[model samples]
Target: MKYISTRGKAPALNFEDVLLTGLASDGGLYVPETLPTFSAAEIGAMAAMDYPSLAQKIITPFVDGCIPDSDLAAIIADTYAEFRHSAVAPLVQLDHNQWVLELFHGPTLAFKDFALQLLGRLLDYVLERRQQKVVIMGATSGDTGSAAIEGCKRCSNIDIFILHPHQRVSEVQRRQMTTVVGDNIHNLAIEGNFDDCQAMVKASFANRAFLPEDRGLVAVNSINWARIMAQIVYYFYAAVALGAPARKTAFSVPTGNFGDIFAGYLAHNMGLPVERLVIATNRNDVLHRVLTTSSMRRQPLQHTLSPSMDITVSSNFERLLFDLYDRDGAAIADLLARFDEGEIAFSETAMARARSLFSSACVDDEQTCAQIAATWENCEYLLDPHSAIGVRAAMTAGIAADIPVVTLATAHPAKFPDAVKGAGLNEEVGLPLHLRDLFERPERCSVLPNDLAAVQSFMASNIRA
Candidate 1:
């Protein structure tokens, strides 16, 4: 399948090219030339299959010409084999109608692993065939850094640099990225918020001549259609288990950059019977306000207990608007320019477009803590601060009861054990066996100021010769 740039100025490329190049040549995100669909019978068969088989079926149409079925299946199988869970992604019933789909079973203990692991393998397969090398630059709030590092660290053909806001992420999250000793993986403690780091990544891509000296660079963030495409699998997996299309299913996603829930929209587009996708946000609820009213604005970010979702600007929202506007690149450019200048006025139609199949709810630190306390007390379920935001939003959103509701639990509770304990949780839920002694590992990390040129110079001078 061909992938077109959201800005519509760049020549359309196939899936692997889009995956390797990341941001399009025209300073726009890549999207599928056209969305593919599957029938209920085909989706029904997914329930009886293993993850690799199902993943191959779900993704093949999008990458049909770029990847042969046999090679793609091998990549899928190899990627999930690294996961700690036998089920790949398991679902735990929370109530009669609510289930929490656990997505933190992979190495880094965050939802990004679900896709990053697979993308890593896909990259290996593609790069090996073409005998090419690429650099990956990513900006993370918290989970994305560790997950990306874990995925790309050992690849000899790839160099990865992750930029995170200094002192904004948790101690464990910080160490997870910083402490890794892999030669290919580098971490930068950027002094600004995630948006600044993201801007630098985009700026580097926009300036074609400013490519990394002696290396080509791509992005591993959700802007990579490959990453977002990989994510759509599990939402489908969860919905199929809960009976989608045959029976409607609703999803409550703990959201930050909007990539995670946008995958649900892709599932809905593929004709899965999604009732409504609920976006759960913490105190930094720029998205919640955007969906609830025409009051869409992004301010300087605030750090919170749910640090991963502490982003002020949602980058993947641009991709959604591209789809919603029927790929009108001019309209997207105008809309984004207005938003960047703080002149983003929302008409009734824009507001209506936002609220149609989507709903949003926001919870504060207090509510997140209360939700964690009550979940542990009443149901004995331990929740990290970000997952607490999701559970609380789903509980309070007053969503229609016509469908089974699934909440995407984004991270392992142990990732924020301190926050869990401080929130009055028991801290006794058994961490999976492998993470038992994670606290004891010696961590190595370099601290760098949050400057793009400083980062560029560091990479130039310090890359392993």
Candidate 2:
């Protein structure tokens, strides 16, 4: 299968190439040239497969030309070997129709681990073969920074730099990224919102001089197609447990970067029988408004208990827009420029289509805390702050009863033990045995200004020196 740039100007590439080159050269995202499909029988056959085997089957078609099945299989195996769970992403029945897919089972205690782990492995193999190196730079609201650092740290050929809002993430989230001590891993706590941090990461990519200096400059954010592909695995794992087309399932995703929900759409595209896709947001509901109506406007951001979802600007929304408008990157670039200037408008048709498949809801700080407490009472299930928003969205939207709705438990509740305790949910729910020491590590990170020029200068000087 070939991958084409959303902008329609860059050369088509196979999957391995897309993984190595995060963004298309035309300043656009890369999408599959053609989506692959499977019959119900083939989809059903997945039940007996292991995580690496299932991943090979799902991902091989996209990168078959670039990465032969032998190499691809090895990469898949190496990536999941580090995960703490026997079944990499496990599904649990929370109630009659509600299920939680636990995804924070890797070295990094967040859903981002499922993707970035594979990404780091893939980069190592590819760059080693090519006898080259890269510097991966990214921005994160919370989990992505820590996941990226954990994945790329100690790699001999690759250096990773991640920028996040200072004092923005939950204490555990901050400590996870800052605590890592690796020669190649660098974390910058910036004095700005996630949007500013994200913009800086994007600017480094857009700059012509930086591209030549670091030809391997890459991204580990959801903007990288590989990240989304890696994330789609759990949806399939959960659906098979719920009976799939044998039983059409739905999902409620607590969205921040918008990559997680977009992966569900990928599953649907790949012939998984899914009914509802509920997108749950905190006060940073820029996407909630867009899915409901044509006005994809961003207001001044709001912070909430769910610090991870405290994002007014969702960067992965650009990939969705590219698909919605039939790969029109010119139009997408126009819309993004408008959005930056605090100006965004969409057609009624686009809004209607988005709403047909997606339902959106926002949970405030009070509601988020309440949902955590209530879920524990109603189902004896403890939810993290991010998962609380998803439960609220699923309940309010009234998930299709005929279909079981899987609400993605994106992170371990133990990661936010403070919030869990505040909601009176500090019981002895078992965390993965390996991550028990997450809180005991000494954090080590650098603080930096929000200025774009300063960041660029730091990157250039450090790389050059």
Worst 10 residues of 1 by lDDT: 206-215
Off by over 4 Å in 1: 208-214, 428-431
In candidate 2, stretches whose alpha carbon ends up further than 4 angstroms from where it belongs are: 208-214, 426-432
| Total clashing pairs for each candidate | 2, 1
Clashing pairs in 1: 179-444, 191-450
User: Compared to the true structure, candidate 2 yields what TM-score?
Assistant: 0.95
- lDDT string for model 2 (1-465, tens) is 788877778899877778877778877788788888888999899988888888998887766667678988988998899888889888877778888888878887789998998888888888888888788899988899988888887567887788999998887788888888877777888999888898887777777474445456888989899998888888888898778659888899999889999999889889998888999999889888887667777688787778789888787777778878877768887887787787688877677777777888988888888889998998787889898888888888887566788889888887777667777665865457765676788877778998988786666555522
* TM-score quality measure for candidate 1: 0.96
CA shift at 225, candidate 2, in angstroms?
0.7
Candidate 2 versus truth, CA RMSD in Å, comes to 1.9
Superposed on all Cα atoms, model 1 deviates from the true structure by an RMSD in Å of 1.7
Alpha carbon lDDT at 403, candidate 1: 66
TM-score of each: 0.96, 0.95
- Per-candidate Cα lDDT values, in order, are 0.82, 0.82
